[model samples]
Target: MKKESKVFGIYPVIEALKANKTLDKLYVQKDIQNPKIQSIINDAETLSITINEVPIEKLNRLTKGNHQGIVAIISPISFPPFEDTVETILATKETPLFVVLDQISDVRNFGAILRTAECTGVDAVIIQKKGGAPVSGDTVKTSAGAIFNIPICKVDHIKDAIFYLQGSGITTVAATEKSGSYLYDLDLKKPLALIMGSEGRGISKSVLSIVDKSASIPLLGTINSLNVSVACGTFLYEVIRQRNH
Candidate 1:
């Protein structure tokens, strides 16, 4: 019932954009004709923010006050500068590990993954600015405060982060059943990044294309897939196991 994470009205939304606020998404009134709305649309598109055009009723429900047909959801946590985070981790840690989340949208799964990453000694988490789960209060609760313990880097695209990691001599591996290899077969002791995709779609083809390797968790039962966060824990602990030996 808290609207603290939202900014309503045209002027406030516009100012939020201008201030470079960490925005998760934008909602505009459908078929509304206004020059300001068009300008906000253009700015949101340029920033790669997810935009939804909803009916006036939906906008009204989001806010009791006049919304002027716009509502912007503010992210709960600030994302660190991607390159600076990566560089600092590389400099400070020997055999640093990273978890690159490719659009993991479920808040519970995302929070659980953060907890696993922190427990498994992952140096940082990389996520896309638009497609991934919004860092909300539920995320904080589910993470059990681990969200504050780990550094998160948000990039424009998942593939770009993978490319940067590879350039920095970090091996990039993706978790997907489409791969022929198993997780146990990989040498994870080196500085590396593990990429996990969304719950329904798994990894996108474009992202999977650039990863240095791909591995799958063995499924012995009829179920072919594991929950994204559960799968992520399995993967991270494997890396920890390999490194410990």
Candidate 2:
């Protein structure tokens, strides 16, 4: 497992948040109660930080000293704002292609998608700040340094990103097995952003509700669904194929 940049102890974590640090995720012991913990929770919620409730044993395993029932991981890279990134993309490209990752927690999977996005001429890769994988050294290594080459936008919620893209006239398409629609049915040559969810659970219901379209890949074998990275490659190449034809 990749080691994360973290801050343990209650007061240190609170000070980090007060300094407006960019945190990847926050882990709090389940059922932890204290004035400081309450303050931390309020700050995290206000900042739209992702919080995970873990057992006390898990907290003990993470650190030897006093963790004070809380830990926060600081992200290595600075995430760009969605609106600015979109504006920049529109200024240069007539029809831009972007990718959004929702609940894809594996750093390797996230890195692979980013690599594909870079190769396929994708304008950007958007992710939900809380649920998505943290961008770290492991991610950069897996991507073969492609993560640095690509632009990433981290938003508070996946659904919000979908709505923002739509408002900008960028067509949104989500990959889900539940949808009766086929990937080839829609024309993807226009300005668009593709939403890909994790294999365990496809796009969240709230996100699916807002997407312009939902599509599924054709499967011939016994496997129920395709790995997200593979499916993402197929989607991007299809866009390229349509534009070339």
Candidate 3:
């Protein structure tokens, strides 16, 4: 998908809906009570497109041009529901390996991480509806089309997702510098959901409180931290290594 193909305006998105175009996701301004907007929302819901309520600033940043408080991401591939993806993983009888991204806003970083996750056989990629990278054309390009292959779930809150995963018997692990245990020490052979946070801010405090195990990659160099995408690769491969053994 190219940059121009990603539609980000209220009218454009509504038109897409009217035309029955396949959309990856849709972002609507929070607290919008307008009847017309509600009609659009209703139409989108009828089509079963993933819709999220976000702040107006997020919509502006997605497109500097007039977005009219709405943005729709058109994707070549349709996204699956979070529950369905989880169920599919379990049905296949494979250890559920999922990735939860906390507020990772950069498109390139998001795409790169998706590429790594796809290569590592991750079942699904979970991200918050707000404060995360918009699934734009650049992200698709950066992932080298891996985004189409991988199932990405946009949730209302990461904490809620963690709770759901825990309820489903999946162990949740947070990869952060604050962790005392090293990544290599964790047993990743079981059903697992690996959480990676944003570049500027680490994992959110609420999310950190819920993770079952917290582990970190041992840094050998003087650098205090690793790039978010690189760190994701390391953590994912560690899971692969452990599962193989």
Candidate 4:
């Protein structure tokens, strides 16, 4: 993490939020009750940022100095609005590719997927503002600096993003084991968006119904499923393969 990226203590964080700074995430000490801190929580929620109430020791480990109960991690990159980004990409690329992440909060997995998304030339990555992984140091490092290169779009909800994409003449594809159709069966040559979920609860039932195609990565072994990042990489490369041929 860069030295100037984080603000320690409650007042600093609260002021940062009031100033409308782009905050990636916020961590507060569990069970601490103060009116000012409550204000911070309200502001963070209003901005749709992910918040965690961790042990005080966790906050202490984040910095050598005193934390005063709250710490705000500033994002190095600013995310574009989901609607504007979609409109811009649709205007340019003939067969634009977008990646939609559903409740995938693991920073490492999110970072790795960003790397693959960048490699595959994805126009932008769409993630839910609240439950998705925060743009933190760990995520940035795991992405191998791809976070800086790729356009990240923050949306109010994953469903809204999907609906908007489909409305704009983009096909939405979901990767989940519940589907019988293999990834190769899907036609990705057209403008499309790929939706990937967390390892815990694949894709939401509502989201599954909205996707244009439900695809699965064929697994030969006994393993039930593949890691989210690995599955995303496999599907992205398959799109490349189909477009080239």
TM-score of each: 0.89, 0.87, 0.80, 0.93
- Scored by lDDT, model 1 comes in at 0.89
Judge candidate 3 at residue 225 and give its lDDT: 91
Candidate 3 structure lDDT: 0.86
Global lDDT of each model?
Answer: 0.89, 0.86, 0.86, 0.89
lDDT of 3 by residue, 74-97 (tens): 765555678877887788955889
lDDT of residue 155 for candidate 4: 81
Off by over 4 Å in 1: 1-4, 18-20, 45-48, 54-65
| Candidate 2: stretches off by over 4 Å | 1-4
Runs in model 3 lying further than 4 Å from the true structure: 1-4, 8-10, 20-72
In the range 103-154, model 4's lDDT, one tens digit per residue, is 8979999999999999999999998877777788888889988998889988
At residue 143, give the lDDT of candidate 1: 86
| Clash totals for all candidate models | 0, 0, 0, 0
| lDDT, residue 52, candidate 1 | 82
TM-score winner among the candidates? 4
